[model samples]
Target chain A: MSADTPPRVPVLCFGASGLRFAVPVAAVAALDAAAPAAVSLAALLGLEPHAAATRTVTVTGGDRARALVVDAPLLLRVLDVGDVVPAPVALPRNPAVLGFARIDDELVQLLDTERLLAAS
Target chain B: MTDLRELVEAAGGERPAPTAAGAATTPCVGLRTGGRWFALEAATIGEVVALPPITRVPAAGSHVLGVAMLRSRLVPIVDLDRMLTGIATPRSERGRVAIVRAAALELGVVATETRGLLELPVADGAGAGDGTDDGAAGPEGASGASGASGGEREGVPWIAREVQHAAILYAVIDAPALVRAALGVAR
Candidate 1:
């Protein structure tokens, strides 16, 4: 609300490998049925692979693009910058992680579209 | 039934004093993880709390279990067992999270059990022998007597040194080094 504070932005939240994650709506180009080129978000995160991904989300960052496969029932929410917390320093350096946001009593890992694509 | 404090006080007075870098009697919180005994300097520890809901991060190393919000701050929870031994600790086996701070970095380390605060004597040098002066025994004694060297263990840079108390050897974890390693900061 302050003059210096950044405004809230819309984000798309989804689940993969039983973990919740979010990314800026601007980065999400399209949401479609599972495609052959879609990559498992769980596999990308080194978690146990989930075979139940029913949707593929096409994300774009700069000139690159990647399809992230995730579970259904996605939630769209507006994220306040103040609610975001920096990732703990003890975690391994991950370019994909922007930080963590507290949304409705749940902690969601925020992702950077460019970094996620690069990681993919 | 000798008290650990009495043993530490007696040991501090009897043993050769450590160098300036090492304290004569260092207060540490004893922890058991990966079936191995370890200690974190009391000054570096903030609090011990039950494991909170953790949100796993993408592309994080295997040692990093996830990040959890503790006291409004996101603290990365490192699985001590997985970090020290290449084995994942069962969720049921995790007992507590010891919130530790090193420099400006703060994180939580999972421990199978915490053995409370202990005043342990640091050896004179980096390669000094174990502090087994009186061969005294107690309740929490003899749980882990791997016969490893007294001071620093080989190949474990994060371990500042090894100290013995009540017949148990505890690897004193170097908080700064651990924080650096956890953040992937170069030494």
Candidate 2:
């Protein structure tokens, strides 16, 4: 960790559309059960939804609360704030992404839980 | 097969040529509409977007082709060719939407294809037929600008000026004025 880097924070890691995704662990109220309400991440990202292995991660919110479906799970890891790079303007515009995080030599897109649920 | 490129080429616009000495230039995104060449100031453009599935709005008016989700914001799509010439643009993948923002209003205008940015020299006089009172319409000078007028279109007065590059004439659209007219807001 460099002097300018922020401390690591807990994130719920998962996979969808063959890409790794992470959401602030605090935003996830619970996991591994049918959500009261949910929207497929694939649908929001405009990608084909995986037919199988769709698991729900209930997100924290009120009135507009919703869940995110992750096709599979990767272990949760503490990601450094400095490791998350803001998305470049040229990338296909999606409001749900906060940025990208590098973990285990792979790029994991950090999801904005509130924006994701609001969009759903 | 339709020669899509030629069909949608900006009217009267020539391929870019060398800049004239001492002539001021402005960057613009060249586009074709109603068989006429038009350019929008590149600064006014927010981004270039693919033609998304526009949700048709009921009774919104002919100028309104509906709205589409652009980066999570629902932006109204106006058929510039239809708005300017009253002729519907044929639907094709070649069609592109230029997202423009002004006066706090962001909307999308469909064009044949964006010819990127070109540095064009301003014309010395009023545009050939782009004057306000003459109501000189473009090649497709059909009729009616909107339901508001009989012959003149709201965008007519908004023609800031004209520019020529490579022998092609382009009417520089006034971004704010265009937005106001599209929203039917009083100038």
Candidate 3:
């Protein structure tokens, strides 16, 4: 990549409560079968609890970790840093929201695993 | 009080002779929502456009419907009806979005319709008042019901004052306060 080009990072995208969200691949330690003890990502985000979570994503930050349950159809994508823009200043500050990026003509809320785990 | 001529002169501008019958006016954009009339300062409004598809944001306040990409910027679309009246704006009633900007913040406030631009007479030394005057004259086709009774409702300050134009009352929105409220920023 040219020096002027922003670096692209891999992220795991998933759905929860009918909304799309993503977290950096580096923060995801494992993707495994759904665990009954896994916390609902939708509930953590203050959305209605998902009826049934099909998978469990193990995310880690520093020495802390969390098992977040999400709905089906998870996908992986690489996003350019420059394409990720901060949430509008008028939006209420949410610690888990790192920024926003448009992928496949859809707006995705990029998450910071550390902040998301801390907020939980 | 300093006269308008003196204020104009101090600003390095030509001072035109004042007319006794001319009242100061503020340019505003008239909006209709939930069958109620409202006006926002024109200077604070960026534009009014047809409603666009919105992507919901997680953890945002209930008043926030979602965000939309307008002019390559992610602008949060807020439900003014919900913010003031606790009623979510139905999709059938939302036809336009008013892009309002104040300080470093911007938002798309949902509207049922736009009444275009208007020049509203400014009340002299008018502070944002409690909207307690139930007898205020309303415009044609207006419901004549007051939605809010004071400068603040449920601790959120929004309306600057009620202005009468063509025998109709338009709640002049305090754009900065509304933006702050949407951001959940303390006064």
Candidate 4:
């Protein structure tokens, strides 16, 4: 790939409060393997927390670790680099979301792993 | 489903002849504002969406209604009716928002109705003022429903150009100039 083009990264696609969201696969240490320990994606994104949310995506960076509670895990897929579109300048400055990418005709907001984990 | 290879082969590769000189046409997105027809260059439009809730700002320009979150971006909503007709538009479910992009600024303009795309001759050659003189009177006179003459520009501005297409007169908006004026920035 050219230096300017972004590298294709693995992400765990999931839904939260009816809206689609994705997190980098690298940040996830485990999924649905442990009890509730991390923060909730809906809470961080200001969405209604669904009672049906059962999956936990455990995120770890260096010595820090946090779990993100979300709806049942859907798929772990490598996103097509071309489908990603950078966030517009008008969007509020929030580190939790980096940009958006299309997955199955749905525009899923890609979560910034580090920032999202820090929110807990 | 059509086979990709067959679809590509069936399409003959031939460049269509360009229109004759003086017959060139420019595509425009037609819209209705304050009960009158208006046109904007198709290239300047980003998308047409429902007018979302606007968060009003204090001490902002008169033309700037407020800003609204559009596709995760907070875009300024310019009240075209208020800007052109010197009257606040009544809130209604029929209102449409036209996302206009120029320079680095992307904003929305609340329109009464979106009339879809239109193709107009590059040059009408029918002289400047055609049909009812509403080109100078803004939307009020064009609609012929009210006498809001005070809102009309006494002098011709660079942003609004009077143009005629298919015997119908329209105020063709200059997107870039309009953006610059809305932001109060000299270019």
Candidate 5:
């Protein structure tokens, strides 16, 4: 599994308001359109560009997986390197998402893949 | 004369060891509405935040205030008014949200107003002090029926004597029952 293997495709989402994000091939908890779309910490921070705090999102702790609730937002697809990102500050609490990285000239929060799996 | 203890015992499953005088212990924090009071069983609360802006989800069903991010999970928001008051009012400036996590589930409730939490005398029916604010969506309140009625307050109004303008009565609500009912899980 080196240069011989192809990178996994990551999925992108287009929020109804036209917000787009690149999600990891693995960190997706579940895609639910349940009003007030439910999402996970990984899924919420796992996407593409967003202005800090301006993007209203609700985070909840769940069993096996935390839901990333979205409302009127659509989903897209992309490729994920499956990179494992650690949170800069140690979280004393659960669902603590990690800091950000610059991708394609846009800042994004790298999600911890292992933790997402353990929860899922 | 109906001894109140006899009335409670008459409808009892288990009774605590009674003191000879039946002196009441410390009072707990409970929300009052319609002249009645309710106590939220402690030991199960997670965190509390102001009611956040909720996006509507098509086909998600009423009572769901879209999803707000609590900590990190995307738990659906349940409008307590729809659960207890049987009405669906639009999200206005006056509302309270209480987020509680229990048994791997996190819940946020648009209480419209948050009556402070109180640890009350443990009643027999108060089984499971699970501290679970069940938010499955209960009784369907008249949706948007109160949109024009904006003069509302937040939190449960136990102190009816302190009523305010755009006043809506706060019912002594059971969080779990409202959720179950709204989710269509139970009657």
Candidate 6:
């Protein structure tokens, strides 16, 4: 915990482009896996706010609530919540955009949903 | 080959006879554009409302038409036609909003039209034509082809019917694709 680090929030691990971690509540979009694709997706057991790789990003929900789904697994090194900085522009580093996923003991690309949406 | 109706008749003796495919087709709201039918599994749909006011999400992509609020859900409505055909088409006469259910969160789409819920016949006629529109409807064909199978035949243009009066065109959307795209899970 440092003077500059931002606070940590609960996050879910999504394995996609690379190992990436994000808060489940902040990631809004997803895959319509089933047919008749409309789903009433219930809330997932949200991330454990304070653990390794916990990061938070504020977004303009505007009138909606969303969950963040990253494309990768979280890193081993824990991020000090105090050092986090939520910038209106793209995230410089700290929060991962390039990472890997732990799929059956293998690492895959996990996407950064927060940045993806923000970038768009 | 065993017909689908026979299989369903065997499983749930009381359920409607299955079509050609063995498993009972899930009740889906089929959105047909161009020549194919894209079914959004009914389970994923939250509320199907007529397209109200869609406020533009500045700098949003082509797939994203705009945003609309449904029952306080404040959903981000996507444009299925543009997302699929890759060619921009006129919005349906009865444009609609489809609130979708995902694994962790909910999303809404601005469907050109909301075809009433459908119980598709199993046989999505293999080797059937994709019912495409003009030269504009390219690129998406090869990419979205392998996935468009299993949609029951309805019409050439109105293949993916959103509703009876939807006057729709194009194929059914695989909800996962939309979700993945939103989450940046898929490229």
Best by lDDT: 3
Q: What are the iRMS values of all candidates?
A: 2.3, 13.0, 1.8, 8.8, 12.7, 15.6
CAPRI-style quality class for the chain A–B interface of candidate 4: incorrect
Taking the tens digit of each residue's C-alpha lDDT, what string does model 3 give over A31-50?
98556678988888888876
If the candidates were sorted by their DockQ against the true structure, best first, what order would they fall in? 1, 3, 5, 4, 2, 6
Question: 2 or 3, which is superior by TM-score?
Answer: 3
Pitting candidate 1 against candidate 3, the one with the higher TM-score is: 1
> Cα lDDT of model 2 overall?
0.63
True contacts kept of 4: 0.02
Which one is best on TM-score? 1
Per-residue lDDT of candidate 2, residues B38-153 (tens digit)? 77866677777678876443234577775666554467788766676677766667778888777667778887666656665444543534332222223242232222221344
Relative to the true structure, how large is the alpha-carbon lDDT of every model? 0.72, 0.63, 0.74, 0.63, 0.38, 0.41
Writing each residue's lDDT as its tens digit, candidate 1 over A1-120 gives 689879899999988888788989999988984568988877777777665656788889878988888876588999987778776654664678777888878888888888778777
Task: List the lowest-lDDT window of 10 residues for candidate 2 chain A.
Answer: A85-94
Which CAPRI tier for candidate 2?
Answer: incorrect
Cα RMSD for candidate 1? 5.7
**Residues B1-187, model 5: lDDT tens digits:** 2222233335441233342334221112233222222333333334456676553332235556555544433455666445445576445454556554333344566654444422222343322222322232222331212222222423433111111111222222344544444444433
Question: Per-residue alpha-carbon lDDT of model 2 for A3-27, expressed as tens digits?
Answer: 8767778998887766677888878
Model 6, docking class: incorrect
TM-scores for the candidates: 0.81, 0.46, 0.81, 0.50, 0.40, 0.40
For A1-120, candidate 5 gives per-residue lDDT tens digits of 698786665643334222323345455544442435444332433333333332233222233444454433444445444332222221112232233323443323333444544554
Candidate 4 lDDT score at position B71: 65
* Reference-based TM-score, model 2: 0.46
Poorest 10 consecutive residues by lDDT, candidate 1 chain B: B126-135
- The pairs that clash in candidate 2 are B11-B36, B11-B37, B14-B168
Question: In model 4, what are the clashing residue pairs, if there are any?
Answer: A38-A67
Q: List fnat per candidate, in order.
A: 0.77, 0.00, 0.63, 0.02, 0.00, 0.00
* Model 1 Cα lDDT, one tens digit per residue, B6-55: 44455552343443435565567787765577888666777888778777
Q: Please give the ranking of all candidate structures by lDDT, highest first, separated by commas.
A: 3, 1, 2, 4, 6, 5
Each candidate: RMSD to true structure? Answer: 5.7, 10.9, 6.6, 10.5, 15.8, 18.2
Residue B173 Cα positional deviation in candidate 1, in Å, after optimal superposition: 1.5
Docking class for candidate 3: medium
